[model samples]
Target: MLRDRDNVFCFTANNLDNSLSRLTFNSCTASSIPSSTLQTPPPITYTQPGLYNVYFVSDEGLPTMQVDCKQIRVLPQPIIEINNDTLICQRDTILLVANGPNLYSALWSPVHNTIPPFDTTSIRVHPQEDYRYNVHLEFTQGGGCAYDTSVLIRVSKVFADAGPDRFVADGAYTILGGPRMSMGQEYSYVWTPPTYLSSIVKPNPTSRPLDVMAYYVTVTNDSTGCFHSDSVWVRTECTEIHLPNAFNPVSDVAVNRNFGLLNNNVVKLEYFKIFNRWGQVVFETTDTGKKWDGTQNNIELPPDNYVWIIDGYCVNGKRIKKQGTVLLTR
Candidate 1:
């Protein structure tokens, strides 16, 4: 009689007499075996772990029969357990663990950015994109058994682009456009240097900066907590030119009554001219520092509205022209 751990078992009988007519066997195990006329019995498999009894009978056709009985025991197979699958952001790491009894060796298939020497029960893995990892376990010393399992990990990529740099007039209010990004409706936007912005939390905000400045926006994934940032330069241009409405030549020695450029951006004055009500030129000058003192050829003009036109160039080499009516008072 013999006991074994494996589920399948084979039995054989030997005798000197070769005239054996028939042979039959019966077992109390969960499965049944086929009858055989030869000396070897067919193999049988047991489903459950337990003790089993077998009875055998042989007939020689001479009114004589031989019978034998035996008892055998079977053991259960080893069990394997592994962790469940998961999802993570790009460039992130995750741990994989496997559990088993009397484990001789373990291996992970489809090699990736894993910690070196992946024979241990636990390992750290870094996958660039989505991947599936397989774990093969073996038990050789005590009981020869092998098992196979796999786990899937999904990697999501987060990216953001804040469009391009923009140019606007100085001290002017304009709408700042937002960036084009992926993973729509799953991200939040925030603008930095919120002092001159109409809204800080919105993707597109209004800005009115007094000088040249740079702005930045950060985009974050709400579910994964992944963030990316980009900047948009708010380049300011010297496009503003202010003109005075009225000036006084008499009793105003301290203040110049000249109708000249009032902005600090003008670098050179191309031409300046004054026109009366009948479209006749009264005063004209090509010098930027020269002023119209409400006089024509050194004569005090009357207190009436007069049209003035000024053409100049800014420090940035941009052409500028301004026309307005100024009131003169004696």
Candidate 2:
């Protein structure tokens, strides 16, 4: 059965016994059926449609009669084509490729509910939460049956712990830890130098120097909703500076200036010589806070016990020389 209008081709063959209607029924011969035996043959037009095989010959100088076979099958119109969809994180495997040409299986609809029964076309969905995926394909042509189309897969959220943030300053105290999640997911921190000092015990931390701190940390992905955060700012200072045993080198804002706590970026004084224990030379200066009133050479020395030779520059630029002994109290 075939029907078309315009280029005209209409066929309906039931039982036409003409025996061998003197050959020449062309279907354009490249062998796709219809070859020889003409009575009234001239009607063929097919743009595209299935199964077709028709060849008949009963005599044409002998060897032109090879039975008579006829089979023209063309009834195809069941389309369902889909390819390319991806979401593979932590792997639940969603790879479905459908091509149309006479299919016979595939049905998957997941919004969360699948363990072992969805009738495959390639579906492995074990999404315990957050989901969207649909599929339906069942095609059979010859008995006429068709259904195919499905697209929806967006499962985004994959974070157990996403890196970088660490702080440690152990002088007045400050400690923090990070980038943690591998099956040891148990974290809770609500800290901002609160609790009067600071305490974070899920990764261990403690800090309080004078408490000039602003810190934030929130990490919670216990089962899977994904969470990660970090923040840091700790500036606490009281770092060593205590020197004032006795400074009365004749007060001028009370002796010398640079008795202590004068870090001109880690103070640098090279050779601040001063002697006087009968070794002469007193009240020298390397500009490291030059001060020595019980002088000599400028004359004023008599209460002796001063043999100082201090040279300096410390902290990562190291250079220090010492030969101390000082007490010229007059």
Candidate 2: where are CA atoms >4 Å away? Answer: 1-47, 54-67, 81-114, 120-124, 127-137, 144-157, 162-330
User: lDDT by residue for model 1 over 192-262, one digit each (tens)?
Assistant: 88867889777778887656667787878898887777777777677866667888886556444566655
Query: Which residue pairs in model 2 clash with each other?
Result: 23-37, 23-38, 24-36, 24-37, 34-54, 51-73, 57-65
Instruction: Give the TM-score of each candidate.
Output: 0.51, 0.29
lDDT against the true structure, each candidate: 0.72, 0.49
lDDT of 1: 0.72
Instruction: Give the lDDT of residue 46 in candidate 1.
Output: 68
Question: Considering every candidate listed, which one attains the maximal TM-score?
Answer: 1
Per-residue error at 204 for model 2, in Å?
13
Q: Which lDDT tens digits does candidate 2 get at residues 1-330?
A: 232321223232224443444333346433332543345445554446656555444543444345455565555456767645544434355555565777788777753645556676665564534465667665676654546466555543433332233332213354554444333544444444454244653444555443345666565545554455556666533323222333344556643422332222235667666666777666666665445555566666555466666666644465656565656544
lDDT of 2 at 102: 72
Model 1 vs truth, CA RMSD: 11.9
Per-candidate count of clashing residue pairs (backbone under 3 Å): 0, 7
Error of 2 at 64 (Å): 7.0
